[model samples]
Target: MRKSSSLINIKEVLLSTRKVLNENAIIDSDLESDLLVAFALKITRAQLHANINSPISISEQKTIQNLVNRRIGHEPLAYILGVREFFGNLFRVNESVLIPRQETECLVESIINYLRHKSIESPKVLDVGCGSGVIGASILKYFPNIDLISIDISPNAAQIAYENILKITNNNNFHVLVGDLIESIKVQVDLIVANLPYIPTKRIPTLQKEIFLYEPKTALDGGTKGVEIISRLIEQSTKILKPDGAIFLEIDPDQKYILKNKIQHLFPKHKIKVLHDLSGQERVLSITIL
Candidate 1:
C-alpha cells in the first residue's frame, strides 16, 4: 500500500480545523476544534493531546471536515457530537430534545438543597417538560431513593429522556412518560421541578442560530408572553402537589415578578423565592405550598 501525500498529522489537522472554525466566527473555536477532531478520531480530548503528533488518515480527515462543516452551518455542536454534558453527566441529545444549559443547573441545585433540608426519605418528585431528562436524571443520580416521573409532550423527547435517565442513574425509581404537563399524572408528588420553554415567541428568532435554526421550536417557544406553558404547569401542579411540596422552575430573568404574582394568586399562602444563577440573573423560581 502507498501512503497518500494528502495525509496529515494530528497537529497539522488540529491547526487547520481551529483556523476554519475561527474563520467561521465560531465561539471557542480552539476548544470546539479540539472536540471535533477528538470526536472524529473516537478519542478523548486528553487522548488527542497525548497523541498530538499522530498521523491522520484521509478518511479521518474527511470525517472531521464533515463535522466542521455542519458546525459552520450553525448546527449545534452537541447535536453533532450526539451528547451533552450536564451536571457532570453526559446525556445524549438530538433535535428532538432541548440541549441542557449550564444555568439550568441552578434549578437542580435548588431542588437538591431543598430535599436535603427537608430530609424527606423517598420523596415523590415530578419533572414536567423533561427534555433530555437532564434535570430529573441529575436529581435521581444524586438521590437514587427518590421516586421521579418525567413527562414530555414529544414521544421522541420522552424516549431520549428515558434512555438518559436509565443510563445516568441506572435506577428503576424513575418513569419517563409522553404527556402534557402533569395531565397524565395520577398521584400527588412531594416536589415538582422543570426547565420548560420560557423564551417568548417573538424572541425565538433573536436566539442564536444554533438554537433558532437547529433546535426544536416547540421546546423553545413559551407562547407569546414566554410563560404560557409554565403558567399552565403551575395551574395543573395545584392538583397533584402535596400540601408541603415545593416546585422549582427555571425561568427567564424578566419573568420572576410576573410568575411570582401568578403563584401568589394561585397559592397565596405559599412561599415564593427567586434564585439567581452564577451570573446573578433571576433564574429559578421556588414556590412552596403552605
Candidate 2:
C-alpha cells in the first residue's frame, strides 16, 4: 500500500502482491503473486522474470493492485487471469464455468492412452458437463480425427466451451451442444467423459470460498446424494453407448465406493476401474461395457 513511485519495479510489485495476499490468508501466495504480476504486465511468466528489474508503469501497478484485490475477495486466480492451463494448453474461463483442475487431466490422458492402441477410428466422444470445453477440446486436440460432442446445461458455459474448442483446434470435427447430458446427444459414442457436480448438498457450504463463492453453483451441486448426476449418466449411457463403449468419470476422492456401488447396481455387466490421481486419491472411474 505504498506510493506508486515506490512499487514501480516488477520485484516491488510482486512483493507487494505477496504481502497483501498473505495478509488475506491466501494459500499459494507466492504462485498467485507471480500470476497476478505477469497477467497485469501482459507478459508470460518467463517474460515477467526477464523484466524483474524493469519498471512497472503507474497504470500497470494500479492494474496489479486491482487484481490482487480480487484475489483477496476470494475470487479464483483463473477468473482473474481469464484463462486456465489444462493438459498443457491454456483455455479461456470465467465465472460461467468451473475452472479446470489438474486432476481432470487424468481423465483426458486415460482416454488418450486407451485409444492409442484400439482399432476404433473416429471414435465418438461425449463430454458431459463440458465446462469451458477443457475435456472435450483437449481430447480432440490429441485425437483430431475423433468425432467429439460436448454438452453443458449452462448456456454461459456452453458459449465459453464453444469458443475454447474453436480456439484450440480450428478443425470442425467437434460439436458443442447446450443441453442436459444425454438429451443433447443423439448418437452413441465409443467413449463418454464427464466431470459433473459431485459435491454433496451438505458439503457445498464447507467448500473453499474460491469455489463456492465464485464458481457457478450449478456446476458444483450434485443434489442430495452427490451421485445424482453421475447416476443419471450411467442410466442414459446405456441408451447411447455402443456395446463396448466406456465412460470415464472424474469424481471426488471420497465418492468412489458409493459411486462404484451405484454403477454396479445399474450396469451389472460392466467393468469398473477406479483410477487415482497423481496424489493417489481415487479420482477417475473408468467403466467399460463388457
Instruction: Give the per-residue lDDT digits (tens) of candidate 2, residues 1-290.
Output: 34355547888778888899999999899999998999888888899988788888888878887898899999999999999999988999999999999988988888888789779878998999999999988889888999999899998999999999999988789888888888757787899899999989999999999998999999999989798998898888888999888999999888888888877887778998888888888899999888
The Cα RMSD in angstroms, rounded to one decimal, for candidate 1 relative to the true structure is: 1.4
**Predicted candidate 1 versus true structure: per-residue lDDT over 146-260, tens digit per residue:** 9999999999999999999999998999888999889889898999998999999999999998999989998999999999999999999989999899999999998888898
Clashes of each: 0, 0
Best candidate, lDDT? 1
The collision pairs in model 2 are none
Name the runs in model 2 displaced over 4 angstroms.
1-7
Off by over 4 Å in 1: 1-4
User: What is candidate 1's CA lDDT for residue 154?
Assistant: 97
Local distance difference test values of all predictions, in order: 0.93, 0.89
